[model samples]
Target chain A: MNAATTTRRESIGQSPRALPNTSSVPPRSLPNDEQRLLARLRQSDEQAFDELVTKHHGALIRMAMGHVGDREVAEEVVQDTWMAVIESLDRFEGRSSLRTWIFGIMIHKAKDRGVREKRHTTFSDFETFDEEQEDAVDPSRFHRSGEWAGHWAFPPQPWDDQTPERLLASQQAVQAMNRAIEALPVTLKDVLILRDVEGVEAKQVCDILQITETNLYVRLHRARERVRRAVETYLEGCQRAV
Target chain B: MAHDASQSVHEEITCREVVEWTSAYLDAHVGEDRKQQIALHLAACAGCGAYVGQIASVRDLVRLLPQTVDSPSESEQVRQAVAAKLRRQ
Candidate 1:
């Protein structure tokens, strides 16, 4: 599904709520690529920092945007992430890629933001919804017609030869999927986000998360299942309506 | 044959085994025997396989979401904000 429909912007021209899509951009890996850039950045090279920011700004924004769901808030988070990165460069031990380091800081910032947001207002409890059996209502009870499954065959994938109209519809589904992903438990959310969205390798996720490979996999596996169910349930609802 | 859902611990995957397999599986480092075991379990166990598939979809969905690019000027706002902080440090 196109990601735009599920992600509504506060304004017509404003950026939509960001989904954590990092794999397409490879900055999360390549420790050496980062090292070279950091070397220049450390020398007080304003241009170097500018280059780094320009290259990474969108991904970072998207990253923060996923956590906060607001463009202005996400923008601030990215700025804070860069500031934190600059301040901590000297302490960076080349243990992980610069991207990971920056992201770690961003996650912390995002979590902090989440805590504040939680205290200010209550968010809807999606758990009750999750608990409801997806097919429990027995789609047949309502329609009395042929099953909806025949009309639907796994919505065309995002990269498929989708029409502009179809793509737009798909984007909405993706946006809803993003919300479900965000609602996942932190442990599962982090593992899935890092492994799937960011496209970090299993080894990198383990290193960055400081968890054993075994633990990471279990979390990843379980997390993936949750997100998939969430996405499937969402699409199923849309299909039934059609 | 499907293992009895009400079977004892001995009849089901132990917590330790699940942990061990999960670790190896994450690293893509599981051996053939354990791999087969996991695959068999996953294939027969809709719940477990659904778990694996969800993560896969999440990963794929995240990868496929189109990036929301902003103007260069928006980035400059970040640069300017950080530059002041950088000067102090």
Candidate 2:
């Protein structure tokens, strides 16, 4: 096996079980640290609150930006979310993880703000994409009717010596990925941001977005494919210039 | 039509299917039976192998990219606001 394939295998081995049978498993409880943090926050401990905000603020802003389309507005939405969290802290039932609850509140506020601004598309607006009908990768990349039907007609060229560090090192490539992510429909964008960008677990992402695991995977794949396509296009352009 | 026997043997799962399942496969979400099919296919098909590897790279790289940053002053402003609100309550 090639080095890339070996790496892929090892990575898969290390992955958390992505699709747990939620029905069979008990609902997740707050981790002890979160429980202690909640207790401290309830006691009006400024340090605890500060740590909470610091931990989640950047991701909240990024996620809100995906919905509100303005950094300032996104920041405001997150601020409002923090305010809501404080107001509702005593009422928090621990039905979900604290992070999930916090994110859920931010998404609610961001979507409302997004609607008021009318600059950003809401999740309902994504109905037009028809998730069932859309193929994440371009169909033309696959072969037509033949023994090789459904095989790659135009397979992606392996990126030479590509590593995350190498990919991020390229200013143009980074911009390409950022643009691609920004252009995604909000539904796709939410899953990517929550699951990949923010490192939220698969199950919590579903809770935050009110989506099923199946829905999460579908949207996540499509989102990643778009970013991958952006990088591929950028690399192809670089090759052509060379 | 002549084809490589090694490639043909593993064509039970198509490249299109593998591409679609790439994310789930990388996350180890697929069923064992289907996972074996994909693994067998990837072992033989360099195209699918490259495609999956790129998608994996993209997934890992995205979180490492510089995300939206709140200026230190802005963050402090937020902290102060939250602190004040907590004090009031």
Candidate 3:
């Protein structure tokens, strides 16, 4: 790993306050293409702004949906996020990737809108959800007593034929995974969407969510486990039907 | 079983601990000591291997799944709105 990644990994157990101020520290220097894009955005190039919105709007809407009541409200939140992005375009230093900055803004607005609407539980309430107290895997899956007590009682069956392409090819599997992701509590959902679905790096994800690496992995593992369970269930049903 | 001997020899971490560490292990985020333990356990334990494989699949599949993009008109509308806001500023 590079020096930056090494530093991020070493910061794992440090308190958030003990970590360096990420806002003051740009995660990395912006890539040349991103720098060019930012310059065009600042120049009031409508096409450039359009490109930015089109690129991120879908992701923003999907992520916002995780926070709020419905698609309409999610759209509103994203629209507001775009306006905020436009307003702040000039002020955006290359501290974070534009994608990271845009996501950070949308998450802030989405949480605010989610609170105002009261349609969903807020992040503060989720803070009490207690990552430490929950087991990502079902405890029943393990034995209760004996030498192998903590070992798998019913280990996951191998998906010999399953691949990413094949899994997505199955409509039932796709639906199952989407439902599993949609059903996640906002805390788990946020990390999963950003880290797994959006393909953000772990460090950038931590930066976007203002979470520690420890919390990010905890939440991300839970999220992935939930989806894995969903796919497992779907596969089991398919087996039974055969 | 073929794994029983190695399982007993490398009993420092259980399948339970392996399950918890799967994501970090897959991401290479765990410490070298813990990483070695988990790697040895995974080598001996078929259950943990399958579980880790499934989680890894889930991680890759999530990004590969089709994203829901906005309709063209909706995209046009957002573009216009953003353009208008940029002009107003």
Candidate 4:
């Protein structure tokens, strides 16, 4: 093989996909295209900035929506995030990517908005988080007539078919999730949303939240567990109907 | 009341350990040791197991929900508004 071909093959083998997955890779940096665009953006290239905004605005909007749950509020949050990105351009140290930088801004803006609205649903009641209550599941409530041991032994059934009804059921489940998330303490909710829902890495969550890795994991663990408990109880009711 | 609070606190396991092991148990993250630890703990501790099961259920439920995020209609509106505002600057 030619030297160029051999070199290309070696490079591909050394890429990120070849590496073992670990939390070492920090989140936020410029993708090649984004880096190029940022250079142009620094020059005040309007088209480049426009393209960047178009590509990312939708995602930012949805992220805002998740935090606040109101369309208008979400739109405003994204708007403010963009404004912050523009205003802070001079200070952009390129420590994280422009996207991460913008998201950091958006998260703060959305959370601040959430606090300001102070309008929350009844879902935040502390009584609902009582993990002890889950143990009260009545054996009689389940159709345990069959071998209880065998029942426990069997794997959980795969989800049923995709249908409109299934879709609605799932939406209800997500609503339950959102409510559960909304009920979490602000710090926990931020970690859970950024790490779990947004699929950001652990390192990124820690960076965005300005928390140590240990503290980040602690908050994430508690937040995730709380959301799990709430969603489980919600689904348990749905299971009864099936 | 004192007894109940103490028992509940005593019952609490390391949230970090559980969270660390859960991804492995769920097969999203891999490591036999973690899965084993989580499985063994779950077997011994029903409450933590229930909590684990709840997380798995929530992920499954998200699959059933509608794709509501970043709907094209709303997205375009926001895009135009932001673009206009950016242009003004």
RMSD of 1: 12.7
Docking class of 3: acceptable
lDDT of 3 at A40: 80
What tens-digit string does per-residue lDDT give for candidate 1 at B18-68? 322443454456655555566655655543453344344455566566554
Q: What lDDT score goes with residue B57 in model 1?
A: 42
Considering only chain B, report the TM-score of model 2: 0.80
Chain B superposition TM-score per model: 0.46, 0.80, 0.77, 0.53
**Residue A109, candidate 2: how far off, in angstroms?**
1.6
Instruction: Provide the overall lDDT of each model, using Cα atoms, as 2-decimal numbers.
Output: 0.55, 0.77, 0.77, 0.54
Error of 4 at A55 (Å): 6.1
Per-residue alpha-carbon lDDT of model 3 for B1-89, expressed as tens digits?
11222334334898998898788889888776677788888888999999999999999898877665457777777888888887887
- The CAPRI category of model 4 is incorrect
Per-residue C-alpha lDDT of model 3 across residues A109-175, encoded as one tens digit per residue: 7877887777454554333357888998989999989998899999998877546667799888898
Candidate 2 ranges with C-alpha deviation above 4 Å: A1-28, A119-128, B1-11
Angstrom error at residue B51, model 3: 0.8
Error of 3 at B12 (Å): 1.1
Cα deviation of A149, candidate 1, in Å: 26
DockQ of candidate 3 compared with the true complex: 0.48
Kindly state the fnat score of candidate 4. 0.15
lDDT (10s digit) by residue, model 1, range A82-149: 77667655545454666566666666676567555554433542122222233312233232335432
TM-score of chain A of 1: 0.55
Model 2 RMSD in Å is: 11.0
